[model samples]
Target chain A: SQQGEEDPQALSIQEGENATMNCSYKTSINNLQWYRQNSGRGLVHLILIRSNEREKHSGRLRVTLDTSKKSSSLLITASRAADTASYFCAPLTQGGSEKLVFGKGTKLTVNP
Target chain B: DAGVTQSPTHLIKTRGQQVTLRCSPKSGHDTVSWYQQALGQGPQFIFQYYEEEERQRGNFPDRFSGHQFPNYSSELNVNALLLGDSALYLCASSLFRGGRYEQYFGPGTRLTVT
Candidate 1:
């Protein structure tokens, strides 16, 4: 299935505190992507980490991929109130069909 | 450039009724994909359209179908709706060439069935 299931379905943190979320997938993937959704709105793409790459960063977001464990983690540094949202990870399977498999996401709450 | 766009922000229907949702892909993108997201869950891929054809599909049933127009717009039609069918229907657009996997999502159309 290659579905990326996130751990700790929910998390609460204070403003300026860092929040980390973990995701584990079922199969090998070409790349893993992270997305954030505010409330029930559309998902905003955060970052994409390729299979060969161990880590990638975008602004306050840091993503690390461990293909050996078929898992990935997203770290948000100095999170603000605006960072409160539902985070999702998508694992894109290698070869064959190129559809993304997503799991139930991790809901993050950043208190001001 | 404008990102992906969807029509009918919210919809209400009764069981056994039919509903159709629409989406317009991002500029210069030729592929569109549809997903169904239940409350508190992630989006589930329904199907994908590329070159005006269904290229790949998920585990959804035939009751859920879609079409892509020549202008890169798409429509999702569901027949014989059920209470379980109520969800946020999301449409995403991406370039299908060169194995690009990044997608731009539209503010989903929230559907509620009674």
Candidate 2:
């Protein structure tokens, strides 16, 4: 079974609108990282938030982590058509192996 | 700096055949990891290699094995391939810091098992 589960598997928003995606995990983690993948392409690292932190911001992306609830959310503000892609949250386990398990991902389509 | 690179972007093999995929880690990176991604799903970790030795392995079977060279480049070998073995094979590299890493990924080799 996958360690991370994302909600609203697919989303569509008009250009300039905001998009928010949520994720829930089953185990404790050391850090949570988000990645974006264009259609049929490799993933690009977006942001990484340590477990001790609650929120992080990078450009138009904001990520919030709630360890107590074992959940995280990614918010993309003032979106554009180029932002259309698949977003995945990978929770790194607290171990030497540094395992990075990914969820099915949330597919976002920003209509121009 | 050069990012991770994989060879033979695409391959086709029949069932019961064998295939070897290669990867070169990002410059200055010493750890390498492999993943298998079926369509419509997330990548599944195959194993990780460091210092010319395997450091970790996932739930894959013995038919799926790997090797790492002194230069930190790696190879993933799938023996007795099955139809289900077809997938996008990805290689990732990272600097090992206290057992934690921010991995850099390759474009991946797409394998088709006939």
Of the candidates shown, which would achieve the greatest DockQ relative to the real structure?
1
For model 1, the superposed segments whose C-alpha errors exceed 4 Å read A95-97
| Cα-based TM-score, every candidate | 0.96, 0.95
- Model 2 stretches with alpha carbons more than 4 Å out: A95-97, B98-100
What TM-score is obtained for chain B in each of the predicted models?
0.97, 0.96
Candidate 1, DockQ score (0 to 1): 0.62
Best by the TM-score measure: 1
The pairs that clash in candidate 2 are: none
CA error at residue A79 for candidate 2, angstroms: 1.4
